[model samples]
Target: MALLPAAVPALRAENLSKRFSTTLAVDDLSLTVPTGEVFGFLGPNGAGKSTTIRLLLGLLRPTHGAAWIFDDPVADVARAHRHLAYVPADVALWPAFTGQECLDLLAGVGPGTDLAYRDELVARFGLEPGRRARTYSTGNRQKVALVAAFATRAPLLVLDEPTSGLDPLMEREFRRCIAEAAERGQTVFLSSHKLVEVEAVCSRVGILRTGRLVEVAGLEELRRLRRTEVTVDLSRPAPRLRGLADLPGVTDLRWASGLQFTLSLVGPPGPVLRALGETDVARIDVREPSLEEIFLDYYGEVSA
Candidate 1:
């Protein structure tokens, strides 16, 4: 039997670092996204997410380490770029060109493009194709970039805060496009602070914090490792919750209106269950925290 060769990853970074003046913008970051996977790079603002993106795009050279778009090194800007399409956080278009013209130009420059799908995207995004770029609003400009990127035949799409000025309805449409891209076997590297958006599309996520890669895991695995929020309502007031206060893996304990107790729990619930038996509980609600809550655990009061 003959062995099959391994497929090249869509994106790869090893010990990637970037520094601006005295500030270390991106610090020793490493990550990989397999071909055709929708991967999310999650972080708060100024967590060096954009810096990392720039480095990957070869717009900024890393102070150390390297990155690749498939087998092409990012240092070879033109070669690496041929393998991916990029939509930045902020988009700037040729003011004199109409929206349709802009889309045409983008399609022409890319490795290839699905022109029929591009037309459909223009309609789906509600872009006024005849309008000059200068007349387009911020959201419209973003739409132009999105339509171009999504319509391109490039294997990988690098999106940085891709939904900047989009309204909720358009945001939903953008997510739909992402699903279509994945269905077509396109790899997407999505960088954003929006937990809900990432949770909706990304199969795997890497959390960046202060220029460093802090965690990378599947959503389910991340949830399992984090604390769950639990609320308990008692039939009547208990004299004390002495055991719960000192209970292992219990934190943020508080008493609410009408004998309600709320707290976060981690690890085994056996201890928590045993303690609750001491009180006359009316109702109990336990839920896995939202992705945003999990994000907050990693960045508390850090302006996420």
Candidate 2:
């Protein structure tokens, strides 16, 4: 078999840590985002997601360890930023400038911006370029920032809850844009609490807990950490599912009706399937646990 080429690293962190007086804002964190991959950084409030981003952006000096953008040390902020664009959770624009003016100013200052692409983004985002920044709503301000970032030909995009202010329609648009960006070979480091967005778009996710990275895996791999919900319907009066619940992976067995029952299974399905095969099985429905459920499981363990 031919070996696939190794992916180039767009962002790399090694034992990165940060401190604010007595508080350790970010613990020894190490991770890598390969070029063109949409990597999700997930955590609850104050889980060091923001702090880690700042460190990657070189806005804060790491107390220990180091990070790089396209192999350029983040300590060299100007050089690293040349290859990346960032959109913050709370966008603040110059109120005195028109939306178009802000876009132009940002493009002029940023490296390798594509004006033609910017125009397309403006149209797609439904932005009013003529309106002053003060006249735009929160979502509109966010759109302005998003347009600037996405329109750029930057190698890396660091988005901190980029869809926070967008409505459902616009949020869908944002996801579409992200997919397009990834298709164009841009690496997106998305930090968000929105599990749905991550599950929909990200190839892999890293979970942070109280400044520590507790888990990092692909979506399918993470799903395995949780349970599967099974709903069984019996053709006749349900046979006593003796020792079924006692199986290693089964839990929360409940009989919803004379012919229906629901149970959750935590591991391989081989044992469960064999047991179900012995009964007069009419129908069976199995659902994998969602990313949110898996996140909660890891979160509960970390909290404990």
Residue pair clashes in candidate 1: none
Our tally of clashes for model 1 stands at: 0
Every model's TM-score: 0.80, 0.78
lDDT of 1 by residue, 123-213 (tens): 9999999999999999999999999999888889999999989999999999999999888888999999887788899999998877888
For 148-234, candidate 2 gives per-residue lDDT tens digits of 998888888899989989999889989999998888878899998777788789999998877888888899975555678899999
Give, for candidate 1, the lowest lDDT window spanning 10 residues.
1-10
The residue ranges of model 2 lying beyond 4 angstroms of the native Cα positions read: 1-8, 225-250, 253-296, 299-304
Give the distance in Å from residue 170's predicted Cα in candidate 1 to where it truly belongs.
1.2
Scored against the true structure, residue 176 in model 2 reaches a CA lDDT of 92
True-structure RMSD, every candidate: 5.4, 5.7
How high is the CA lDDT of each candidate model? 0.87, 0.85
